[model samples]
Structure formats: C-alpha cells, structure tokens
Target: MHTTPHPPTITTVAVPPGSAIASALPGAYFADSYETTDPDPATSALQAWLSTVAQVPGWTNRLMALRNRLVRLAGLKDLGALGGDAAHPLRDAASYRVGDRVGIFRIRHLADDEVVMGQDDRHLDVQVSLTKRQPPEGPPRVALSTVVHVHNTLGRVYMALVVPFHRRIVRTLLARYAAR
Candidate 1:
C-alpha cells in the first residue's frame, strides 16, 4: 500500500478544450476530468486504465449492484459487476484491442498516452479517456476524462440521477489509484 512522494491526491481539472474526443462527441451534456501525478513514464494508457479500474473498492461495487438492480427495473441494462477485486485480481491483463470489453465499457481508442473507452446505449453515449503526460521539468501525470452525450429525456434524467454519485465514485476511484 505504498504511496508516491508527490501529493497523494487527484485533482479535478477541465477536460482538454477542443480535444478530439470533444470534436467527435459534440453536444455532450456532461464532461469532466481528473488528474494525478504519474511517476512512471513507461505505463501504457491501457495499463493505467485497467489498473485504475482494478482499484475500485468493494463498497463501490456493491453500490453498483444495487444500482443495477434498481435501474434494471427501469429497463436499463444490467452492467454486471464493476471490476477485478482482490479475490479476482487482474494480473498481467492483456489483449488490449479496439473492440474488447474493459469492464462495462468497450475499448474505443488506444494510444501511447491515452486509452478511450465507454458504453453507447440508446440513452447516452459515454467516452472515457485515460491519458499520461510528461511535462518538461516535473514528474509525469495521468489524467482520466469522461464525456457524455445524452440522446433523449431518459438520458437527461438518468444523468441527473447519476452525476452526483458519479463524481464521488470517480473521486474515490482516482484517489485509490493515486495512492498507488
């Protein structure tokens, strides 16, 4: 459970303006970014993304299960369990491809510094990106960003109900990854 010498915190930042993700996903009703100091420049975006997801805590998964049950009653998709846990850890997870499933999301794009993945449903289309950057004079940093385009009133209501909890859950997840 060792942490980095740098601040063990993740900062909520603005999503890169006019980024490609934004260009492709215009009219997004919701978008946000979270950043953390990433010391290792060798880490691939897919690795960072998978490792971060693997950090999802048990309570969060439980909450998701409850959410799944409730949402299913509304005819929403049952997303199943969240991610790999200690009991079922993700060791040497590979097969990173464009169409592969990464938890509830699919691999949409993979690059050296960023991997973009998310779910597209009748209600909304979500695109999530995990990017790593190496500034000139400081330790490297990693960022996770999400952009959502809602398709209808159902999407808006669903987003409204989820956005608040979404922020808290994402902060908790990113903080856990930052601690690593």
Candidate 2:
C-alpha cells in the first residue's frame, strides 16, 4: 500500500492547452484539472485511482451505495457487468477504445499518454481525461481533468448536488496516487 508523510496537494488548474478534451465540447459548465507527481503511465495511474475509488469502504461506501441506488432509480445506467472477457480490474490499454464502456462512461479516445472518457444523457454531457507528462528535471506528472456541459434544468441541479462530493473524491483519489 502507498503512504505519504502528508496528504498530497490537489490544485485546480485550467485544462492544458491543446488537450483533446478542450475541443470535445463547447461551453463546459464545469471544468477542472488536478495533477500530482507520479512516475506511472497515465493508464496505470488512472487504473489505480479507479480501483481506489470503486472499492469505497465504510461511511463513504454507504454514501456511494445510496447514491448509486438513487442514480439507478432515476434510470441512469449502472456500470453493468464487466464480462469475463473484459479486462480484470480495468487497467488494460487494449480493452479501451471508442465506444467501450468503463463504468458509467464510454471511452472516447485513448493514446499512450492520455485516455478520454465521456457520457451523455438527456440532462448533461461529461468528459474526463487523464494524461501523463514527463518533464526534463522532475518526475513524470499525471493529471485528471473533467468537463461537464449541462443540457437542461435537471442537469444544472444534478451538478449542484454533485460538485461538493466530486471535489473531495477527486482530490482524495489523486492524493492516493501521489502517495504510491
């Protein structure tokens, strides 16, 4: 397990210029990116983050379980069964491609340094991108960014309700990766 002397910092930054996500949609209602130093490839970092997030425990688990149930009750799709043929633990690069579903999002694009996932519903469209950047004098950095465009009043309301928990979860996930 990964450990850190202190919690890793998660800063809000603009989406990097020229990111595929920047051009994926217009007028995003919410967009934020958080980056931390990590030598892992973007895919691996993302997979690790997902593993941590999906296996929620204790109070957080109960909260998420309730949230998932509510989302299902509203007819939003759950992550559907990941078939036996599907990559276990969802870390395989080859398993992701346009139209592939990973949890509630669809893989929109994938590359050596980045992967883009998105979901569109009657109320909103959401896109998430993960990227790894190697610098000349420092450890490689991994960033996760999310952009959302709300389509209606319901979309706005949903975002309002989710943004708080969203911020905490994203920060916690990145912090976990930094510790590793």
Candidate 3:
C-alpha cells in the first residue's frame, strides 16, 4: 500500500539562551524564532520551504503597498516586494552558495546544519538563521531565527510599525510543510 508522509508543524518557542542567531546582529533591536521537528535533510528542506514564503501573504502585500507610499514620501527607497529579486541571482535554494541571495536576505554563512543570511540597508541590518539539530535518537529539530538592528530613528520607527505583522507572518510561513 502507498502512503503519503505527514507534514511537520511549526511552533513559536522561547529563544534558546545565547543562541547564535540572536547574537548574529550586534545591538539588535528585534529578534524572534520558530521551530519544527524535521527529518534528515532538514536544512535543505527548510531552505526550500523558505523560498516559497518570500512574497508573504496578500494582506501583507497590501500593508507593504501602504508602507511603500509612505516611505517614499520620506525619501526611502520603495522596497517593491518582500521576495526581492529572486528571479535573477537566486532562482531556487537547491544550489545556493554562501554569497547568494535567498529571498530578501543575502547568505552570510551556509552549511548542512545551518544557514545565516542578512541584509544591511541604510535603515537597519537584519540577520536570519535556520538551524537543524539532530539528536542521537529522535526527530531533528529545525529552528528559524531573525534579528534586526536598527541604524537610526527611521529604522526604529519602521520596525515599530512592522513588529506585530512580522511575528504573524513568521508563524504563518512556518505553519506549512517543508519540502519532502
């Protein structure tokens, strides 16, 4: 008999004390994380799944639209979309290198156990990490973390406005399945 595999469920968890992701961005103004138990190839599976969530949700797009209009008024570049330019430099996560772009983040470090990516703009510097921890005899746990460091008043204001939606977005993205 043939059967389909069950998908993993993501959950919000307290940041592991002194986790690398939290320290990735110095003087970070915001940080959060989510976790799921995955199997072998956890890092790759998580990477594949993250590629699908770059654009975020429709409601988020609407909010981005409003943000674009307002930020433009303040002479900030209109960050066209959440996904960034994945079509050119980064078509997929299957063949990404340490310097490649993954959605809006640039890969700072990559490995079988973890990936560290971030972007530094005039407003802020943000870092993200996806890690897989395999135990001796249990399902592997995958954790995704984000840290943002504000560079100025504008950055602080921008983060303040988006913090609420950011958590929800992260949860929504993680609730889905990782690639098989």
Best by lDDT: 1
The C-alpha lDDT values of all candidates are 0.77, 0.68, 0.68
Model 1 TM-score, all chains together:
0.86
lDDT of 1 by residue, 17-130 (tens): 544455654577899998878845687888887778887888888888898898888788876665743333444546667887777777788787878888887888888887
Q: Higher lDDT: candidate 1 or 2?
A: 1
Largest TM-score belongs to which candidate? Answer: 1
The per-prediction CA RMSD against the true structure, in angstroms, equals 3.6, 4.2, 4.1
Model 2 clash pairs are none
Error of 3 at 131 (Å): 1.6
Query: Which regions of candidate 2 deviate over 4 angstroms?
Result: 1-4, 41-61, 73-75, 79-91
Clashing pairs in 1: none
lDDT string, candidate 2, 1-180, tens digits: 988577666667777667788786478898888887764554553464454445443555455557667778777644432221143345454556678777556778676667688878888889988776776787777777899999888889889998988777667767766766
lDDT of 3 by residue, 41-114 (tens): 53463364465355366886677678779988988766555555435334656677778766556778776667
Model 1 worst lDDT run, 10 consecutive residues: 84-93
